[model samples]
Every structure is written in C-alpha cells, then in structure tokens.
Target chain A: MKARVTVTLKNGVLDPQGKAIEGSLGSLGFEGVEGIRQGKVFDLELADRSEAQAKADIEAMCEQLLANTVIENYSIELL
Target chain B: MKARVTVTLKNGVLDPQGKAIEGSLGSLGFEGVEGIRQGKVFDLELADRSEAQAKADIEAMCEQLLANTVIENYSIELL
Candidate 1:
C-alpha cells in the first residue's frame, strides 16, 4: 500500500517558514498572494497490507515520528 | 480564493532525507516501511479572482518560485 501523510501547524501556532515564503512571494511580484502556510508531505510505500491495517500503521507512524502533535496536526491517507 | 500547491521530487532523484526517515522508522520498530519520499505543501489564500485567473496565477507562481522544475514536479489545486 501507498500512504501519504501531511503535517501542518495547528491553529494559533506561529509559522516562521510560512511568513518567509509570503515575504519572498511579495518580493517576486506575486501581488495577489495574501497569506501562505507551509506544511510537509510524506509519501511512503509499504509492504502489501489490508487497507485497515495500513491506515492503522500510518497513524502510528505519524504519532511516533512524522508529526509533533503538540504543535502540529497530521492527516494520513491510504492509497 | 484558496490554493494548495505540492512540490515533490521527480522519480529517480536521490532523496537522502527520505532514506534517513526510513532508517529511523525501522529504529522505531515500524518494519513494514519500505520506502519514503518527502515533499512540501503550501496553502495560500489570494484575492478573489476567477477560477481561470487563479489557476493561471498559481501556475506562474509554481514555475517562478514554488518549484525547481529541473528536479521537482509541482501540482496546483484551487479550493
């Protein structure tokens, strides 16, 4: 199975990297850009497993390593 | 309008960071993990525009600033 995980900063959390990207976009003349938030995407290939098992495993992976749960939120999708 | 852009490394490209993550997963006792690739996601808000215009503007942004076309591939999604 293939899985994708996206980790994003939680609401009320500050994102310095996103701010930097917004500033750069302004400098680059992308005038319409109002705000930008950045996040991470991880694509993982795993040994074949049932959909339910894959999802469970991926959730564990996020909780353990893929995300810092206190400040970030992570979503896992199985494909 | 809201837009989401994902930047991913092209296939066949080396990804040492991903390899490191995979090794760490094994250390974490997640033996099913076979391979992993890391990518980036950007969530942006823009001034109201027609969908066509928004799409065009985002395409330009990707080509000019969001992606390194030589080794990365980017996909833009309007929401």
Candidate 2:
C-alpha cells in the first residue's frame, strides 16, 4: 500500500515561510494572491499491507515523528 | 477563491531530507516502511476570480516562484 501524510501548521500559528512566499509572489507581479500557507507532504511506499494496518501504522508515525502535534496537524491518505 | 499547490521532486532527484526521515523512522521502530519522499504543499487564498483565471495565475506562480521546474513538478487544485 501507498500512503501520504500532509502536515500543516495549526490555526493561529505564525508562518514566516508562507509570508516569505507571499512577498516573493507579490514582487514577481502575480497579483490576486490574498494569502498563503505552506505545509509539508510525505509520500510513502509501504510494504503490501491491509488498509486498516497501513492506516494504523501511518497514524502512529504521524503521532511519533511526522508531526509536532503541539503546533501542527496531519492528515493521512491511503492509496 | 482558494487554491492548493503541491510541489514534488522529480524522479531520480536525490532527497536527503526524505532519507533522513526514513532513517529516523527506522530508529523510532516504524517497520514496513519501504521508502519515503518529501514534498511541499501551499494553500493559497485568492481574490474572487474565475477558476480558469485562478489556475492560470497559480501556474505562473509555480513556474516563476513556487517550484524549481528543472527538478520539481507542481500540481494545482482550485477550490
């Protein structure tokens, strides 16, 4: 099974990286961009496993290493 | 309008960050992890615009700022 994990900053967290990108876009003359938030994506190739098992494992991974949890949120998708 | 841009490293490009993540997972006792690749996601809010226009603008942003087109691929989703 293949899995994806998307990690995003929690609401109200300061995002300097996103701000930088927004500034750069504005400088480059790409107008109409009101706001931007940046996040992380992890694409995984896992050994063949049951869907349930894969999800469970990925959840654990997110909880343990993939996300800070205190300031970040993560979503998992299985394919 | 809202848009999402996902930028991923092109195939055959080395990802030291992903390698480090894989090593960390193994050390943390996450088994069945065959491989890992890391990418980026940008969540963008745009001034009200047609879908086609939003996509076009975002594509230009990607080509010029969001992505290093020589070694990365980007996809845009409008919401």
Candidate 3:
C-alpha cells in the first residue's frame, strides 16, 4: 500500500519561510503575490496493511513524527 | 486567486532527509515501512491575475526559488 500525508501550518500561524519566498517572488517580478504558506508532503510505501489500519497508523505517524500539532494540521490519503 | 505548488525530489534523487525520517519511524515502532519521500507545498494568494498569468508566474517562482531543478520537479495548480 501507498499513502500520502500532507502537513500544513494552521490558519493564522506565522510562516517566515513562506514570507521569504513571497518576498523573493516580488523581487523576481512576480507582482501581486500577496502571501504564501508552506507545507510538507510525505509519500510512503507500507506492507499490505488494511486501509483502516493504515489510516490509524498514519495518524499516529503524523502525531508522533510528521507534524507538530502545536502549529500544524495533517491529512492523509491511502492508496 | 490562490495557487498551490508542490516540489518533490525527482526519481533516483537521493533524499537523506527522507531516509532519516524513515529510520526514525522504524525506531518509533512503525513496522513494515519500506520507503518514504518528502515534498513541499506552497500555497499562495495573488491579486486579480488571470489563471494563465498565475501559472506562468508560478512556473517562474518554482524555477527560480521554490525548487532546485537540479534535483527536484515541481507542479503548480491555480485556484
């Protein structure tokens, strides 16, 4: 099985890296770019686990390692 | 308008960060995880630009800033 997890900063959280990228975009002539927020994606290959078990495992993965729950939210898709 | 850009290590590209994460996952009792790859997502808000223009601008953004074309591939979606 394969799974994809997306971890994103919660709304209203400050993202300095995204801000820096936005600033660079403006300097590079990308006008009208008001803001940018950055996130992470993790693609994984797992053994033949059931979808339900995979979801539970991935949720635990996110809470334990993939995401900082203090500032980020995560969602997962199993394939 | 809003846009999302995803940058990922190209196939065959060595991803030390991902390997380290996978190692950590095993140590944390995530069994049967064979491999993992990590990517980045950038969400942006733009002024009233046409979707075509936004796409072009974001392509430039990825080429110049968001991705290292030497080892990464990026895709952008406008919303």
Fnat values, one per model, are: 0.90, 0.94, 0.92
- What is the per-residue lDDT of model 2 for residues B1-79, given as tens digits with 9 covering 90 to 100? 8888999999999999999999999999988799999999999999998888888899999999999999999999987
Where is model 3 chain B poorest over a 10-residue stretch in terms of lDDT? B49-58
TM-score of chain A of 3: 0.95
Better of 2 and 3 by TM-score: 2
lDDT tens digits by residue: candidate 3, A11-75: 98999999998888888888898899999999899998888999999999999999999999998
Show the colliding residue pairs in model 3. none
Top-scoring candidate (TM-score): 2
Misplaced by over 4 Å in model 1 are none
Candidate 2 structure quality by residue, lDDT tens digits, A4-75 = 899999999999999999999999988888899999999999999899999999999999999999999999
DockQ scores for all predicted structures: 0.91, 0.94, 0.87
Against the true structure, whose lDDT is highest?
A: 2
Model 2: residue A70 alpha-carbon error in angstroms: 0.6
lDDT of 1 by residue, B6-78 (tens): 9999999999999999999999999788999999999999999999999998898889888999999999898
Better of 1 and 3 by lDDT: 1
- What is the CAPRI rating of model 3's predicted complex? high
